[model samples]
Target: MPQKQIYALPNIVSPANPVIFNPDICNGCNTCVEVCQIDVFIPNPEKGKPPVILHPDECWYGGCCVNHCPLPGAISFNWPVQQRAYWKDKATGKVLRDSQ
Candidate 1:
């Protein structure tokens, strides 16, 4: 019997400001994929999912994903002086602060 080879996935380089995806809210739509200019995500085969963060260090912190998700209270970020940890309109890119 021959043993199957396992491959190692590339690891995220860690961002200066760490951000996380709320799986509860993520529909696995890959909307973030179309928007990201930095190539931060790669498809997850095991999970049958779209782009997962391939390089967190490359994140521009531009809050593009935070603004694009249609699900309310989906994406967010926590940084000093600005805790815009909530979802927003994809068109206007406005965070729903009052709801939070």
Candidate 2:
């Protein structure tokens, strides 16, 4: 008889999620999950709900998930405060990041 061995996944803590899903806008299409190159998301168990961020730290800051989303506001990308780059606009005198 072979003994069954079970292993649990580690709960890794990250500073923040690079990508976030808007529950109000996301239609649970799973498009972002399919488009992610780094496999950062896992399908949500509940129907019509946004997918779970299983591996937020694995995100490569790629906008594929956001760009491929059918709804404009379904997915959004965020840069960690440490990595967020800001520059002063000469014309407007407003500090803004690349995304802005």
Over 4 Å off in model 1, which ranges?
Answer: 1-12, 46-50, 80-100
Put down candidate 2 lDDT per residue, 1-100, tens digits, no spaces.
9988967957556745787678899989988889999888888998789988888877887888899898999888877778878889899899887764
What TM-score, over all chains together, does every model reach?
Answer: 0.55, 0.76
**Which residue pairs of candidate 1 clash?**
none
Best of the candidates, TM-score: 2
- Cα RMSD for predicted model 1: 10.8
Query: Candidate 2 local accuracy as lDDT?
Result: 0.83
Candidate 1 lDDT score relative to the true structure: 0.62
Clashes of each: 0, 0
